[model samples]
Target: MISAPLTRRAIFAQAWPIMLGQTTVPLVGLVDTAVIGRTGDATALAGVALGTVVINMIFWTFGFLRMGMTGMTAQAEGAGDAREVEAMLLRGVVAGVGLGVVLFALQIVLIPLALETMAGGGALDDAARGYVSARFLGAPASLAIFAINGWLFGRGRTRAALALQIVMNLVNIALNLLFVWHFHMGARGVGLGTACAEWISLAVGLAIAGRGVDWGRILSPALFGGGALRRLFAVNADIMIRTIALLSLFLWFTNAGARLGATALAANYVLMQFVSVSAFVLDGFAFTAESRVGQAIGAGSRSAMVRAIRLTGEFSLLAGIGFALLFFVLGPALIAFFASNPAVRAQAGAMLPFAAIIPAIGVPAWLLDGIFIGATRGRALRNAAILATALYIATDLLFRPFGESGIWWAFMASYLYRAVSLGAYLPGLLRTIEVAEPANGP
Candidate 1:
């Protein structure tokens, strides 16, 4: 069994890398908004915002690559089965590539659908289309990078995952400046920069995997046969359902903001970036929980699993508190950084408190996600998420009389519900662990 002190240190060591990596996407978004805001074009900002909603929907749908792979690989690592570990990595890559291809094809038809659905026949429509089309070009590489990241994290190499993310975001940011500012490519430039960065990061991630892993075993055709593919698909499907439910809430919120007005939509968009920052940081702890819990489960150590849950949960709580305070102290400055229009900044500032409230209410659910995933209890997670999502939609609809503040309040309530409902299920989950354990075994 892993020692408690060693496990605690190792968990953080792994987590900080993921935390740093996760921080980059929002940073890039914040940068993009800041640069575009300087162009004095509200439409450009709106376009990026709308386009991101679409991209996030598409990309995040396949989050199973990271979630499923982490759990499965960690379990294999804990079980001391190198072959199974390699198989999990191989399966993730194949599935990621196939899914990417499907998403890319759909984008051809979907882009117009999204543009029309979001808003049709105007500058907003034009900008959104341009951004979506350009970003779609990188679908394959983007998906590949997800698989690579999952594989690395599964291997307990959070540092590698972190490095790849840093490289990808840094490159994307630099290219964004060159294309958007120097080349004057606007939304398309930003999209192209993101796509290019994904490809470059995938290349680097592949190199790292090759150096660190036993690819010969992983790539065997026997392991890539129908049974392996079917299992991976099953896991991914459950995760897809869970992710769809999760993302749909955000999508609906954005759509609702759009219905309000451009300024409200933009304000919501900017504030959501702050929420993303918290979510990403919290995800570090989630990743730690997944790896450690999966490892414990794989090794058939109930005590270790319990310890991991406690330690990771504590860490996540602390992180959430830190972010909440950070938002309270520096929120206005952060808002100013993203919005050049004094008016936009003022609007976003008004909403910053709502954003700050997310981590406090949402961190528990986030951490539980990793724990349940490590336990391979995807069905439970999918069900709980769907329930929470249903409540979110219901609450939002009920709060319609109160305007945006009401909507934000409902959003906060949704996170709280998710955390509580998921937490309530933990006791039963622990009982299952006890039942699964051999009477006298570790």
Candidate 2:
């Protein structure tokens, strides 16, 4: 019986918890910016902002644990392979923890290189170092949580995922207040709080996962054998490279803003927050795409995957539009809330329209990303990213004479290109799958 693949109720059931969970993430950043900005020190603010970006680059690069795990595990789940799901979780957690160890070991060299690339050093460098060093403490725990979260999402345990995230973020915020406000610990305090929160969340996730699986059955020598290992590495490596390329573009954006100096950097930093918040919202639907699409494939239901994609993509689009409108209406107030420095505020206010336009353009790009991840379409993603990034660089150069607005234009255009590029490829990919089935029935 071919029917609608997903209902609005089904989509909402999946999306709402993810959205609510994600909402708390920005609160941590907002709190950090508000508390640190209140210190009336632009240099410190810029350092923390820059530090945050660097930390994200390092951590997010390993985001393959979450993404790769989610797709694989969700498919296994839909196929009713409980043992495979367990192995997937174990593999992700193992890889994540190992990568975290490597990151911590390499941070000393990595931090300096990242800083110099941004032309960051001096007063700004000192504060950023303080912040990043503190964050480094939780690398292992943070990655562990990534693996844990991915597994939870794969199982369609959205509410549990939501609870874990909310607890983690709340812990971060509380500690941020204690250290930065009361103890006057500065940027280091912010980092430490975030680190501690990550470890705490990992503990909670482990407890939940423990209740669901027989660990003795989940572990096996074959888990690391030729076929399974090769698949894991191949999938994760693709996603990792894709992630690195994407992060590089954003890092380059921040670096460009840095060359414009502290005020511009700070302003750009705050504006990116709006972008992040919008992403978080749309990501709710993206996640749904990952779960539902993977599940449908595992169950051999092409119609289900098609239906899930349509519903989730539409939901993401609507959510994105809402973000754009919110930014347009309240851009200034939010900018003001983030920065007390007059110059930073002024610069950010001028760029407000660009910020407002991001979600609208980002809607399709983000939706496609989720779709791709669900289908495990890494090569396509990598190709699109390469093409989009090349164009983005060229666009940035072409608009250089116009200064920051030019940069903003280039940024906006790059996202549009990403969407158009991915959106174009998606239909062809779907057709192949659709054609693989009988004209009338599966």
Per-model lDDT: 0.81, 0.84
Give stretches of model 1 more than 4 Å off. 1-7, 119-121, 434-442
Candidate 1 lDDT over residue span 1-442, tens digit each: 2323436787788788889889997889888888887786777888888899988877888888888888778888877888887777667776777878898889878787766666434787778778888888788888878778777876778888888889999999999999999999998889998888888887887787767577776676778786887887787678779888988877878887777777777788889888888898789889888888887777777777887888888889998988899999999988887788776777788888998878877888899898987777788788888888899999999999989888798889888777776777788877765424467844
Q: How many residue pairs clash in all the candidates, one count each?
A: 0, 0
Report the lDDT of model 2 for residue 365: 88
Model 2 lDDT per residue over 1-442, tens place: 2112378897889889998998888878888888888788888888888999899888998888888888888888877898898888777777778889999999989988877877676989998999998999899989988888888877778888999999999999999989999999898889999999998888888887667687898677787775886797698787887888788888878877888998888898889889888888778899888888777767767777888888987888888888999999999988888788899999999999998989988988898888888777778888888788888888988999999998899999989878887787787667644323356854
TM-score of model 1 relative to the true fold? Answer: 0.95
TM-score of 2: 0.95
Which residue pairs clash in candidate 2? none
Which of the numbered candidates is closest to the native, going by highest lDDT?
Answer: 2
Name the candidate that leads on TM-score.
Answer: 2
Against the true structure, what is every candidate's RMSD?
2.2, 2.2
> Least lDDT summed over 10 consecutive residues: which range in candidate 1?
1-10
